[model samples]
Target chain A: MAERKRRRALLRMGAGISKSARVADRLFLPVVAGAALLTMLLTVFHRQIQEIVSPSPQPSGEQQGPRADVVAYTVDKVPISDPDSPVWDNIPHSRISLADQSIIKPLKLNVPAEPVKVKAAHDGEWIGFLLEWPDSKADTQAIKVKEFRDACAVMITSYPSPPEARFMGTANNPATILHWKADWQIDIEEGFQDLEKAFPNVSVDMYPLLKESIRDGKPPKTVDIPEFARVRLPGTWAGNPVSQLSKASPVEKIVAKGPATITTLPTQDAAGWGRWRDGVWRVVLAKKMKASDGQAGEMVIERGQTYSVAFTVWFGDGGDRGSRKNPSMLHTLYVE
Target chain B: MPKVYNWQIGREMDYWYEESRPRRQAAAVFDTNKCIACQTCTVACKTTWTSGKGQEYMYWNNVETKPWGSYPMGWDVNILKMLGPQRWSLEGERYVYRGKTIFEAAAQSERVLGYLPSDLDYAYPNRGEDETNEIVVEEKFYLRMPHDLWFFYLPRICNHCTYPACLASCPRLSIYKRPEDGIVLVDQARCRGYRECVQACPYKKVFYNHVTRISEKCVLCYPAVEKGIWPRCMRTCIGKIRMFGYLNTPEKADPENPLDFLVHVKKVGLPLLPQLGLEPNIYYIPPIHVGNINFLRMLFGPGVDQAIQTYNKAIAGRDLELVAALLLNVSTDRIMTKFKVIGSSEVAGYDENGHEVVRIPLKEPAVVRPFYDERLQVYRHNIT
Candidate 1:
């Protein structure tokens, strides 16, 4: 009974310890939960507290845009219309003219000459004067501005003020000629006379009626030889004396002249002349013999033989169709 | 007949297709506002690539002044006049020229090549109607208003296009665009100097070298690119304006990283005539100044504002997240840093999800060089 009572006492003691442990657990759990909740609250409010404590960032005017400004604009709002503005002015039109002058001055080019008067077939109002300058080795071919203007003034005075003149410049060189293509015609002789009276030294001419006729249509009946035509050579020949020939004369000496006819008998002799036949002169010669074989020596003609022959040589008119081969006889000649 | 497998098919099948590789190509961007026209790039290119015979008159790379400037006289004016005014139309997904594409030749039955200038036609200097000499030199003469006189130099090179007109127009099929890098090139052995490429190139960059008897052009310095080196022009630029790097591999480069902004979303642009559908790899960042808006519009076209916006975003630190988004083809993560704002800070930490986080500080402003300095002097140095 005592052992049972001791066991009961141990169980009772174990129950009491378990109950205390449970009570301690309940109290510890609440405290842990409260601490955890407090930590969670502190963590949630940390950022808010930092934000409240830290100073707000300075307002950056640059940062407000897409990026911070690297380049500065000093005169951003300057109006182009403002006179004091830094805008550039437009280039004036006068500069173009200056540039043109700068371009043309380097080349030495001259203005054209005025026109002078000339004769025509029809009669009408005078248009203008046509000027002509001859080509020369000297600079005389050049037409001065004053001369051109004076000629124009003269033509204008003679005719109307606004007259048209066609300038026909020479393609060869610097020579220039101005002519009037109009209804009016000037008297050729009278105009020349007036021009010569005014400028005596100037070589001027009025084209002839025949020249005008040729210029109009058909050519002149008689052709005038141009100054550039070539002359023909002479057919005759002259001789110098023998003494002059020895002195180295420029002319050749003539030995003989005849109609070229021969009269001789046919012979076997080697050194003798033969008869002429068939328009040919013939000769004969004898063979020479060897002295050892008792043969005769060969015949030979002597040097410097001057033959005079005559014949009734024929001659032709030598027309376009005639040949020089056959000559008709006009006369006969005799030689001794 | 039984299905016969050919050797070409076998080879084609064996050709390994890199599925992990990015499909979109990266291109170069030139900030014209920073260009100084120092010609250091020009000389470097000349020495490295065009030092041989027949290249005496060729400038492969040249910086031409606007309004009255050209290489080989008036190349721009002559070409612009020949092409007349540009007109455009979108037919489905493709662009058409004069209402016709390359495939439309079947309907027209006309072998229509691109427009070309007459052989005898050339740009000539104004002789003033009385100027005697062929060359009329007037030093520092201004054609427009005095105070408003402004001229910018435009540096030009072959664009190395995507669908290169030069490649298409070549009868010999000598010109090619590399599939790997998208660099357009012509095989020297196959080019017969027909001058079709010269006529066909809208930019007129391809030129005939008389002595070489072959059509030569800018190569984009493939050898230098292979060696992880910038083109001679980009390397030797005195102004440090030109930047060069692989578009996709910009992360591995330093200093002047071209791909950092170019391949990035916010700073991409292209040379004019991209509508020609050549898909040119060269880009130009428009230079902005306080001038007549109409003049700027006329010079750059209607896209000037967008180009300027992109340029500003590139120079400044904004729109960097946009760049990264475009490159990675992903949405911006909370911890992900934008490319534009990646100043001098390093990677800091990772989130619970193991995403990389970075710390960047607002740094002091740095000095960027002007396009041209007032006191800058140009000098010519010869290399033996």
Candidate 2:
């Protein structure tokens, strides 16, 4: 009887163990599968996230005007006057100053002299001036050009010789002849005399291109220098009723003669000039001007005719005397 | 009998070798007159391929105005001045650099200085006028004179060439052009940034990033290209001036095609300066403007007129049938079948005659959307 009871107990124990094992297997498989599915879903979502964050590989066809972000390749925010600005401080201004000294000696002036005036006038209206180079022992002409350029903060590119005067006539035109002789000097008295001979009707008053600075009396306030000058002639010449051609007026027709090729000036708003011949235009850069003021040559074109236009600009030598560098002037033509 | 057999075998081998070489495909043609300087290509390249650090100053692809503009300042003048009046050699197959004639001083200085004064000029690559100034000139005053004119912008990038100069110049041999796809690539891992590649490239497109200290260039967007997408610059060009596609197999490509005229004829016409010995793949359509004829002749060479004539014939001759046929392959639906195979037609819609019509691709695609997930990543596509 005892043996039979033991056998029953053993059978019951084995049955319980088997039942527990079956339950564990049933629970474990689904849990593991659930975990794996969660991981896979996470991976897929991760990939999607990556794609979203990254820039798209495809191009979008839209005609949005140039974005500001796209435009200015580099701002480089150079400080005009602030000394602390990174770009300003790093600039070779001091080296430029040294170079200035070498250029100044040829003008035959002393270290400190009375201030001279360098006036840029147009039609008797004074546009700008530089007064910084007072009694300095710098070359008068050199100082005149240097002070004027520095005051205006513009570039003055110089070619090797007279034949390569690359930038001469106007500030807005392209370069043509690469050279010019720098033999002529700007003398106020001479300039005034020349003006008297050219324009007899208008009183020719002379002013120095540079003036004394009010704040320091020694340094000049480098402000408001025009890139170009406009001169207007008097209405009377040789007893004839000279037409007061408006410097700002549009002309009906422009004729190109001699070496001068008449081309329309590239203007933002002006109607295009008409093409009179192959590779030729009616408008040309002004050569002679009225003595009262220096102005850019006026351009004229027919109202209804299509014309080719050219832009003209002058680049000066950086105030070097012995280098014999001359300005370069050229024109770039375009159809409007 | 044995000698005859040998001759036949030799002829067969020669023919096989010729056939085995990879053939030129449909080249990218840029009509400079049509280019409006929109700079869509620049931004497209920046955002797509070079958005990372050190790429701020790098323009793997850039557009510079001619006559008065240059990338890295004075690249064109410097190189032209260096090469100094190129001429062909006796072999007639190559043009020699003629080192003795070129400007060694300028070239040597540039190699050492790595920068020039014009590089720092603020006036370079000037943008359009401000709105305030625009209104003032337009409404307030009519001075009877116009102002604020701008120079033309010329878009540029790597020309995955037939004989890549960058590939030959690299000491590490990291730069390579794939034989299968014709895509030029620089293996970044192998590149040490010695900058020999930078000097070697006549185009000066390759640039060194101070941050990365490695030379980088336009990759041609290989990933996107593989997926049938055009490069970012080609797709996003605002002026619709750029066209990208693969050249067809030699058997399929038409030899009579006018566009192939320049490539096939070796020396009697205009070709890339041969001294560099790098056979550049990209071709330029010269700008046509009535200016100093002498200057134009000097810059473009004597064959310019003939090249222009051939180009005009290709573009305007035979009722423009040659150009139309080469540009697009027509089917019943007027859908471009040939260009579509190379991904150009897909981006540019098709014309009635199956020529691929162009539209400026500038904006970023709208399909991308953000989602938060367990991986802390942003998801681009919709979740299933």
Candidate 3:
């Protein structure tokens, strides 16, 4: 009777173990399927889910830490006007991709995105950006009818509130541009390029309304001073910025409201320098941090603020000019 | 793309903008047969308009030897080559272009089918000056009715098209055609030197100024045109080959209008390269001496034969109204609105206000001299 009782207990134990095993087998596949479905959904809508979880990280109440593509580290003396200064050795660079401008009437197609290396440094009183990009050729003279010059610009929103960064800016949101032209750089370095410099072999007999210093009762065969005959040059006489032989600064400060609405500001408070070396263009654009003398259209840079910045580059060898350029999307520029 | 009516092609064609015709289109008709290629018009235009520092090489008006010459060194030939082989089909009386125009042939990224000329291209403006079609060999040096080695002078200026390609190609919309007059102009204040207009203009009339860093073209002397005066080039035409006036559409053709009589009634004046579909306002009376039908058809449209026939009839005294119309060309500085053949001997031109501006006799009075003078013993050189 004792042996039979022990056998019954053993059978009960085995049956209980089998029942638990069966229950585990029944639940295995469904659980795995649920896990897989969740994984696939998360993979497909990860970005959307992330947005829902943390809405736009654009500081609403308090001061936010540096969360941007570029961080303008506070340096005692920012290399404000030098592109090739050794002060840029320690600053980290961020790479930005530039795509063609295709949102307007004139579209540039079939071009691959060009990558640019950018670094920023700010003194207590001024801020500067150093941009370096690859270009096979350096075109510095825009003195020929068919020739265009290489150019680059950094656009910062005039107001702290970030607006849409396309078409330079919309009507309400204006973007101030610090445009550094390769030709203008050369213009500031060398004397203003003239027609003779463009066409070395070209000869002219005389020009109307030109100032003359009579040598032995005869005017010189050639006169190089185009300013003396400004009346003959309608563009120069009409005060066109592009036609000006002498420029105060290599960088031009402009404000834009959509394409073709770029207006040069009367008070130009920006300076820049560009150097082309070994098929690469290194440019530095600098401006005052605070608005002085109530300068109109000036982009004021404040501490502990995030501003939206964009970049544009033109390859003169590729016949890029005006709207025909490589443009970068808006990037967050945080000032520490 | 918008479909616009190009009356020159007699059908709707692709254009960048909607159909907006001017209230009065500024038009001109050039008589190629009477042109002497004196280049006085070119000089007059240069002195009056394009005499600036950067405009040294720019010629708003130029006369080139045909079959060889061009201001920008094969401007026409290069554009034709790019356009490839295009054709025009005769649908009833009006010829419809069967091939794609510059606008229609444009790529998705571009507004017009065009090519930018290099700086050297403009360097040689007179590339084939006075060059003939064929070399005159010693064995066959004799002249024929249609000369074996033939050439003609072709004077060109901005056609100021009813649908301007320059205006359409400009991304900034700097180029504009006046609503008051169909004169096209590049705004000095707005142009950013994109050179799209320079490339898009089939005639290559828009020139880029190196010093100004912008593009400039013939303004058609709007300041003078606003005052009821002809352009400098037209007014100073030594050959009297140009007739400047406002043109109306074919449906509104007026027989009393000189341009209408020559273009619509007599079918003498033909648009240059009407197949291009810009509907250029300038018209040309084809050279009757050129026997090459294909060449004439390529320069002018399918109406070349009819134009030559009408012009021949006018010269042969079969079309007196056409003669009166031709005789009134450049007769006065004022824009002639109406013309009349006065009593079979004179042609009278009236201005916009119905004021008779000019009257010219059909034949000048001739004077004859005696064989010898009465007192002097010197015989008269040949008595007329």
Q: Total clashing residue pairs per candidate? A: 23, 67, 0
Which residue runs of candidate 3 sit more than 4 Å off their true CA positions?
A1-65, A110-114, A158-164, A211-228, A290-298, B138-140, B368-379, B382-384
**Cα lDDT tens digits for candidate 3, B1-384:** 999998888889999999999999999999999898899989998888787767888999999989888878888888889889998898886788999899998878788988888887888877777777878687656766566677888889999999899999998878999999999999876787889899899999998887778889999999999999999999999899999998889999988888887888888899998888899999999998875778989999999998998888888988887888998888899998889999989999988899999999887666798899788877998877
- Arranged by lDDT with the best first, the candidates are 3, 2, 1
lDDT of the structure predicted as candidate 1:
0.34
lDDT per residue, candidate 2, B233-330, as tens digits? 77666665554555442234433332243233311123233233333455455444423333334444344455455655665543233343333311
- Stretches off by above 4 angstroms in model 1 are A1-336, B1-26, B87-149, B246-264, B290-301, B310-384
Worst 10 residues of 3 chain A by lDDT: A213-222
| Worst ten in a row by lDDT for model 1 chain A | A92-101
Error of 3 at B173 (Å): 2.1
Which one wins by DockQ: 2 or 3?
A: 3
True-structure RMSD, every candidate? 49.5, 34.7, 9.9
lDDT pick, better of 1 and 3: 3
Can you write out model 1's per-residue Cα lDDT over B1-384, one digit (the tens) per residue? Answer: 012111101111110011122233335556566666777777777766654323444577876655455564655555445445654444563333342222122112111124333322222322122222123345523354211444455667787754455765664456776766666777664553445566567666776543233467888787765544456666565654454433443233321233444433343443444333344566665665423444444444344566677755644767544333223211112222223335433212222244444233334245665555557653324312
RMSD of 1: 49.5
lDDT winner among the candidates?
3
